[model samples]
Target: METKKGNFSNDNTMESIQKLTEQDAKTFLNLIYAILKDNEIPSEKLISQVLSVYEKKIPRLVKARQDNN
Candidate 1:
């Protein structure tokens, strides 16, 4: 993911979801969770954020993997 002028979108932020691999996804989630644990308290928003992060990380968890792995 290429960082833009402070915004995280478009060609900015992380690369498109298709670019992420399984280990990459797991690492991404771990990093986010680590940050959440260090800076934020447990809350619904936190949970939601975690889920959202997971949504990006493990796409298969949300949708069927066409590769059928």
Candidate 2:
């Protein structure tokens, strides 16, 4: 039983959104670390702030991904 709405299906769940595989997590962390290093902003506080922003923007990100798919 699946319902569709604007390119999104009801099959999606919070657990799916929150779950990241170990390799994916490592890659994400590496990318973030590289960006911070390249931009000379390597601070734990900055990382926390960036994560906060990411969390805030997740809804928009999901919509954008759905639109793309």
Candidate 3:
């Protein structure tokens, strides 16, 4: 099987998840839940801020999943 590039693969997502602190991971889960449940768009700035924080703490794999989605 061919390995998928970019954010589409599970490997990337797992890497990101591994980098998050418990609190950060919780926040990320909540954010994703809210978006999916409410069909709302979070503020761009808020998303950017979260991403900035995650970029530093999270693994590239996890970041890739978030980026892909």
Candidate 4:
């Protein structure tokens, strides 16, 4: 199921977070691309960093999302 208020999805996923507004997903993607290019990092390196980040942030994110719901 989905919720169409603005651009956000009610489901639990990164896509849902990105869908917070119509421009959210695009902005998130552009920001990631810009960071990768600016730091000269490979996609794999970015994935590694993302994993490291997820480890630290997923719990907080989950809580935040649940609170929002």
Candidate 5:
């Protein structure tokens, strides 16, 4: 699931997203939606960047899930 230059592949992105809680997952998707809505970036190219941020945020949500557990 790893990639060069700290980039994330789609599979890695989905795996990271699956580790989040329901609410956190919803929030994550919402953030992506907001980015697409508010930015001038083209949808095709922006997907990778969105996935990168989504993957990066997974650790925090995972930590919070573990803490709550």
Candidate 6:
């Protein structure tokens, strides 16, 4: 399977809020909100943090899903 990387825009963020079914997305959003609330930082750094977490989680999440099946 070819995995396509998603490009998220400000508009796409709103769409994701409506469309994402996976729990990880919800957890990530919560973490982002917490990070924003806890610190005053540039938006670039905040986005980088969220992307880093998502990258770290993907392999582990795929493995867990395969195990369950």
Instruction: Highest lDDT: give the candidate number.
Output: 5
Task: For model 1, name the residue pairs that clash.
Answer: 1-15
Q: What local lDDT does model 1 show for residue 36?
A: 85
Q: Is candidate 1 or candidate 5 better by TM-score?
A: 5
Local accuracy of candidate 6 as per-residue lDDT tens digits, 9-69 = 4454444344444686677668767877866768888777766545544434554665777
Q: For residues 1-69, what per-residue lDDT tens digits would candidate 1 score against the true structure?
A: 313543235442234455566876677768776858865556777776765564443454324443655
lDDT of 4 by residue, 1-69 (tens): 223532223244464454345464465556556656666677788776554333323434545756898
Clashes of each: 1, 0, 3, 0, 0, 0
- Whole-model lDDT per candidate: 0.55, 0.49, 0.55, 0.50, 0.72, 0.58
Give per-model TM-scores: 0.39, 0.36, 0.43, 0.37, 0.59, 0.42
TM-score of 3: 0.43
> Model 2 residue 43 lDDT?
75
Q: Is candidate 3 or candidate 5 better by lDDT?
A: 5
Mark the regions of model 3 whose C-alpha exceeds 4 Å error after superposition.
1-8, 39-69
User: Which candidate number would show the highest TM-score if scored against the true structure?
Assistant: 5
lDDT, residue 25, candidate 1? 67
Question: What's the distance in Å from true for residue 14, model 3?
Answer: 0.6
Q: Which 10 successive residues of model 2 have the least lDDT summed?
A: 1-10
TM-score of 2: 0.36
Descending-lDDT candidate ranking: 5, 6, 3, 1, 4, 2
Report the error of model 1 at residue 62, Å: 21
In model 1, the runs with Cα more than 4 Å from the true position are 1-8, 11-15, 40-69
lDDT of 3 at 65: 61
Off by over 4 Å in 6: 1-21, 40-47
